[model samples]
Structures are given as structure tokens and as C-alpha cells.
Target: MRFSMHSTLFDPDALPFRRALIAGIACVAAVVAGAMLADQPYLIFAGLAGLVYVGTLTVNCRALAWLVIALQPAALIVPFFPGRPFWWELCALLAWPSLLAYGLVNRRKIEVVAFDRAERWALAALGGYVAVILGTMAYRGVGLRIFGGEQMGGRVYVQQLVLSILPVLMLLAGFSQKQLRMAMITGWLLSLTYIVSELTFARSQDMAPLLYFFELPVDGLNFSTGYDASGVRRFGSLAAVAGAGLSLLWVAAPLRELLGRWLLVTGPLMVALVGLGLGSGYRNVFASAICTLFFLAWVQRFWNPSRVISMVLVGAVMVGGLYFFAKELPLSVQRSVSFFPGIAISPIAKADAATTNSDRVEVLKLAIADSPKYWLFGRGFGMDRFDRLPVDDPNDSVSMLYSQGMFYNGFLGTLLKLGVFGLLCSLLFVWHVSKIALQLGLLVRRRTPSEWSFFDRVCLLLCAQWFAAVLLFYLTNGDVTWWMQSFGLLAGLLMACRRLKQDEGFVVDSDGVPKASVTA
Candidate 1:
């Protein structure tokens, strides 16, 4: 009763014509794509093309993989700015139509959209964070005057508007399995770009040796340096700096597989990483890098325990030998060419040498003392100044309280902002979503088939990035920029992942490409 003419439909020799078409498609797609997805029409077209592409997916993976990994950073990043001459952007804008068009050509069809626990948490968190931030603003008692109404009271309601709309746009993007793979590959490419630029700044080197694969002119970019002297690395998009480090940390690690052990030598990716570290000049980047590595190592370890133990043992032996030699060395020798200080026995200690831990801890304590207020609708959102007047506060606590506003606006506004119901839901959502991602990650390895796909891996990466960024942001800078952008990206990424997971009809090849490949 089967429709196939032969029993060996999956056999390599059976589908010669289909395979050839797929191969031909792969070779020509990139060369043909020379447009950008700019403006509202292009964005809509991009979404529709994604819809069509997902529908036509057939599963000849080799070529499919090529398309997913093909996008260059210049294609996406440049168009966001006002003026940039890039044919690639035009191609990206137009290529989407081809994906949809492929469905009509081949007639394979699928209907899919993704939704899951992470999306729910993102929704809850975005609401809660905004409410709390705005509530703090209102509690200062000039809430009405600042906005001229009961509106958000931040410095710029505009970025807040962007933060609000971004999630909706992502939801509209209509994620599919192919999209997720494409995104991860994109993430890897961009992360590599950022790291390379950072490293160039550090060593004062040419970007060609670092990012020559794409032939981008990487010279003279400010961040061409590493971690940054201020221990920060801000991105061009938004005033935020927290997530870029996490992104770099991640894209490099999973990317190591693509590079293999040869990354240690003169690999393009390796050069980019080195340039990022050197260019930033910030020690915090090093900390974030360590955290990223440790997380990756732990994840890999979770899958392969014996390999973990062996690596740990080897590392311990090397450290012990170094310590023993340092102890036996003369003071003059130690002073001149010592391998480490007593604390330098660990890499973390060595990196922490030029950092200011005690001062940050002190400043954080000062910031926290003015918190935990009780304002139902407390301070005005835009009222963080010293009451726009000179205050004579002798003590740190009093200074913080008065500087918060002329009068102390306690936690009442916090209640109105959170509204009691939101607070409870926020707590529950965090508990649930965190647990789910952790379970799914381990389950994808231990319980589910190894066929969990690229989108799954990318979602895992997004989670890892968020977690790492949260840790680093808390330690480095507690600015609103850190919180807002982290949550914003997290929200957008989650929604995109949701659409990918929920939609199942798109047939994907092993490397995360659709077979029919969008010809546009």
C-alpha cells in the first residue's frame, strides 16, 4: 500500500536526480544572494520566506547545512545602521522569498510554530522587570509630572519601546528548525567577529590575519581591543555591554569542534579570540571567558565523566609541579621571571590580579542599602538624580536615600508595580523555566535520542549565554543597560526558539538545513 516505487528510497544510489539538484542548489545559493532584508516590507518578506522555506524542507543535509551556515555578519549588522552599501543585505532581503517559493516548486508542505516553558518565563520576566523599574520611578512621587501621564518613567521611553517591540517582532519571525540552525551559525559568526575585533585592539594587529575568511575591513574599530580597560565590552547595539562577552564565550567553544584541536595554532577563529582578549583590555572578559569554558567543560563532562577526571588530574599535576618549582626558586629569580605569585597558582587568581573586587563589593553594598522600599507607586521613573538639587548627606546610607529623591519613597510603589500577583507569578516562572531548560538539556543527552537537532543546541546556547551574562553583569555593572538588553535578547531568542520547537513539519538534514533550499 506504500506510494514509493522501490523499497530502497533512502539508499544513496536511488535518488540521483534529487541529490544532484540539491547539490547544484547549494553551490549557487550563496553566490546568487546579494541583497539585504531592510525596511518593513523586507522584514515581512523575510518572515513569509521563512514560512515558505520551512514548508518545503526535504532533508538532503549536505547542501542544506551550507545554506544555514552561509550568512556573513556584514549581511545582518550593517543594514541596522542608516547608510551602508551592501549587496549582501539586498540578497538577504530577497533570498527569503525563494524559501517560500521553493514550497510551490516542489509542493512539500508543513505548518509549524514553537512555544515552550522558556517563552512563558520570558513573558513573565519582561513584565516584572519593567514594572519594578517603573514602580521605582513612580515611588519618588513625581510619576505623573515626568511622563505627563501614567506612563513608563525611564530616561528614554523610546528604548523601552524598542525593548517592547523586539519580542513581538521575534514572535512574528516564525522560527522553524532551519531558522534555529541558521541563528546558531549566525551567532558563531558574529561572536567570532566581536572577539576578533576585540583582540585586534589589544595587540594593535591587522584584522586580515584574524577575520580574513570573509575579507572584512576590521581595522580601526574601537573594540578591536580585549575585555576593555574598564573591565567591560559594550556592543554597538544598545548601551549594554554584558551579553557580548557571553556571546563570544559561547560561539568560540562550540565552534572549537568546527576547528578541532588545531585551534591552538594559527586558526582564523583562534586569532579572532586572541585579538578579542587583547583588545578589550578588561579583566572581566577573562572572568567571563573562564566561566564560559568551565560551563562547556562541565556540560561535556556531564556526558563523558572519565574524560573529565583525566583532564582534571592532568591539570592538577601541572599546577603542583609549577608550585613546587616556584617555592624552590630564589627571591630574585621569582621577582624577575616567576611563573606566578602565591595566588597565581590558579589562572583565576592570575587574572584577578589587576581587578578591584573589594571596591565593587563596597559600592554594591551602598547601592543595596537604599533598596527594599515600600511604595505602592513609589518614586518617579526619571528621578534618579540627587533630587535635581544639592543634598547635604553626611552618611553613605543617608546620601543614597536622599539622592534617590528629596523624600524616602519606600516599597509601596513596588507593590503597585508588581501588583502582588505579578511578583508571585515571576517567582514561579523562574523556578519552572529554569528547571525545565536544565531538565531538557540533560534529557536531550541522557533520555532523548541524540537526534535532538541544531535548534535544540542553539536554545541551550541561549540559555547558557543568559546564565553566564547574568553572573558577569552582577559582578561588573548593575546598570539598567545590563538588565534590559540581557532580558531583551533572552526574550527574543526564546520566542524564536519556541516557534522552532513547536513547528515540526519542516524536514531538516543532520546539519540543520532544509533540502529544497530557498533559491531566492
Candidate 2:
């Protein structure tokens, strides 16, 4: 192989990739899976990375994946404590510069025209975001309060912004095919492995595994009990399922036909879905599947009508078949079974057949009225509207709009962050990206060799995933683990994918790929 200087960067023999990641895994197993350590700093970083990419870690993504996996035990343990305050400081400070450096280096390797319009809009949009976020945070800082022993929480919040949001802007600066593939490979492999391992452990314990509507090896799960104090029937690992489920759906359209091409591709995922899907009891997962399937249908708009019709028909038949299955359960279990074929349209119910989302609706109403003269500009970035941020009558336009009105630069602040003309631009950018993924997904046949930008696919898929997740969160108000780590990860992945390459995927090879060597 001709050794271009850059070849070394991609070579598997050079960088200490495996060792670093193994060390990370060791940290996780020791810290998270086993016992509480005094506080390994790596555990915090690993958790943040895992949070940012619970779905994308694999040997190929980067050393970070191994680092995160090594730290997985800690990730499982993350909820036990408030993470130390300064975890993301490194990621925050390096955000934009690294993207710019890499983008500039690889600028000649890409077709920049795709993002020409998007870049122009985002640049203007970010200018506004800066003004609004800084201004709002500054203003709200006075009234914002942190929990006891958590006075440093604000710093953590801003640092998180850097780790997640800043990477987004940086990746957007270079929306290349190379980077996108990396993201996809990384997201798919790592997340899948984690799920498998977690499931294996859950089964070994004879515990109730919740994330799927399908089955896994749970020894002692009370299928008959709909609700338990521990929120029974909801898969335990699904705590991270939000990211995994959404990411999988992002690529669903493209992977849809590919699945049919070979049992190797289609059979495993289907079996996996059936085995894992019903166990979780997450309505968002259910809704994501429905919406993603529809989105893929829309993506395959030009495919043979017979194919599309067959899919729809098969889906209907399968769903209908499940209704009979639901009733076949012991009468006690059947009484608790109210998902899919039953409440397919609305996501308000749970495995126990009860509504669980009314609470988010109630909590979002706390912030009200267009108070600040700058209501149009919004309270600014990083403003926790949990204080008093509702901007309009509760009767008007759902909680997201209401919450955005009160805090997030309001409509004006939204404009400022996205620019007066750029909010739609950003929205369009998101929609446009999703559409591209759908198109590529539709065309991607198994083993046929997809020509779409690998990095772009990852970026686009992740964007779609986050778009769905954010949409669900905004629409229904799913809190708790929704934001804990996944939110930051999705945002960062979106940014990273936005700047991928043509053929080089995100996988870290057995070959040594160099570290982040570009001088920031």
C-alpha cells in the first residue's frame, strides 16, 4: 500500500486503540458493574461518552468506544450519584477548533455544495444562538438555583453544551461522507454489543427484561404483573434504549430492503426485535418504530407499489396476529396487556395497560407567560425554564412551543439562535437531512455495496434518530434518563457525523488509527 502521510492516520497498526479502550472497559467493570470506586475520573468521561453514544460504540468507532465499554460498568452505576461537576471540561474546550482543524484539512476531499446553503444559514443562526444563549443564561443565572452540594451544576451544564452542542456545530462545518460512516459504524456496533451483554446478564439473573415487546431470557419475570414499584415490565437496559431504538430507526428505511435481500441481514434484526421489543414497554420505542416505518415508506415512494403494499399488508397481519396472542396470555396477563394492536395510535399507556405520561404534561406547565420584553428572543440558552418559563396560554401549541417561548430564546430567541430567517433553515436542515437518510436507506440493499457517504449516512441517521427522540421528548415530555446521557451523546454524534468522509467509516480498526493529533 502506498504510504501517504495520512494513511498512517487511518492505519490499524499505529495508535494504541485497543489498549486505551480496554483500560476504559476495565474502569467501567470495576466502577460501574462491580463496586463503587472512590471516583475514577475516567469513569465520568466514559459515562459522558457512553451517554453521548450508548448506541454507537464498537471497536471501529474510535478508541472512545473501547474506553466507554471499558467504563460500561460505571455507566450502569452512573445513576447512583450526581457525577462530579467538571467531567466534560475537556470536550467543551476542544469542540469547535477540532472540527475546524479537521474540516480544513479534509476540505479538498469533499463536495461542499450539499451544505452550502445549510452552512450559510447555520453560521447566521449560530450567531443568534450565541447572543440569545449567553444573554439568557446571564439573565437567568441570577434566579437559577442549584441543589444542595450541587452549586457547580451550571458549569457542568455549560460544559455539557460544549461536549455535545459544540461538536454539532463543528461537524456541521464539514459535512463529509467519510465522517458519516464512522458515526454509523460506531453507533451500531457498540450499542448492539451493550444490549446483548446487558440482556445476557439480565437473563442470567432471572430478572424481568423490559426494553422489548419481544422476549429475552428472563427467568423470574412476572408477565402477569403490569406494574411494580420498580416500574415492572419495562426493560432495565432500555434506560439506554431510547438512543438505540431511535438510531436503529434512523437507518430503518435504507436497511428495510436490504433486510429482505438476505436472511443474514433481515432475520437477525427481526428475531432480535421480536425477542427484545415487547420486553421494554417503552411507548416511545413503539412510536419510533411506527413513525420510522412510515418514514421509510415515504422514502421508498418510488419503489414498486407491490413491495410497499406487501409490507403494509404484512405489518397489518402481524399486528392483528399479535392481538390474538395478547389475549392468549393467562387471563391475568391478558388484563395487563394493552400495547400495539390495542393502543397503537396513542403512546399514553404502559405494559401494565396504564397511562404513565400525564405527569410530564403537568410539570411542563410551570413556566408561563411572555414575561421578558425579549420574550420573542427567549430567555436564552442554558436557561432552565423549570423556574417560570411558560410563554403562552397552556391551551395553545403544546409544551415544547410553550417551554421554548418562556426560555429557549422564545420564537425570537429561537430566531436568534437559528437567526431571524434561520430557524426554518435549521428545521429544514434537519428535515432535509432526515429525507436524505431515508433515500439512502431505501436504496441500500444488503451486500450490494451502498455508495452513499458512509459518514453522511451515520450523521443523517443520527440526526433522524435525535429528531425522533427530541420530537418524542418535546411532544410527550419524557424526562429522567432521556436527558441523562443520551441527549448530549446524540447531539455530539450529529455534529461528528455532519463531517464524515466518503469510504472511511467510523470503525476503529485493529490497525492503529492515530489519536486526535491535529493541533487545536
TM-score leader = 2
- Top candidate when judged by lDDT against the true structure: 1
What is the lDDT for 482 in model 1? 26
Q: State the lDDT of candidate 1 residue by residue for 1-520, as single tens digits.
A: 7666444444556675568667887666533443333334566566567656555443322233233233323323333333332333333333334434543454433232233445556566666656655554445443223446443234333234334434434454444567556655554455445444444544555644443332222223433242343223323221112234345444443433433454344345433443344333334444555565556544433335655575577547745764676434322222222223452233332333323334344434443443344223323335434443233554543344333322211122223233344344434434444444454344334323245455555666655655565556544543332234445545455545544543443433332233332233
TM-score of each: 0.49, 0.52
- Candidate 2 Cα misplacement greater than 4 A, ranges: 1-115, 142-156, 164-183, 192-231, 239-268, 271-275, 300-303, 327-353, 357-474, 477-520
TM-score of 2: 0.52
lDDT for position 475 in model 2: 49
Q: Which regions of candidate 1 are displaced past 4 Å?
A: 1-122, 133-153, 187-279, 297-304, 314-355, 372-381, 388-432, 439-443, 446-454, 474-477, 505-520
Q: List model 2 lDDT by residue over 1-520, tens digit each.
A: 7766544544456465556666778887656744534556667666666655433322112333222322322222222323332213333333345444545555563344244333344434444434444554555452224443312225423542454344243334343444334444454444444355455544554443332212322222432243454344445344244445444544544554544565366645653453355455544445665555454434333346777686678667766765756544333223223544443322223433442334334434333223333434434333344333343454433454444332222233334322333344334444433443332333332123254434334444554455565465544543311232434444444434433321233222222121222233
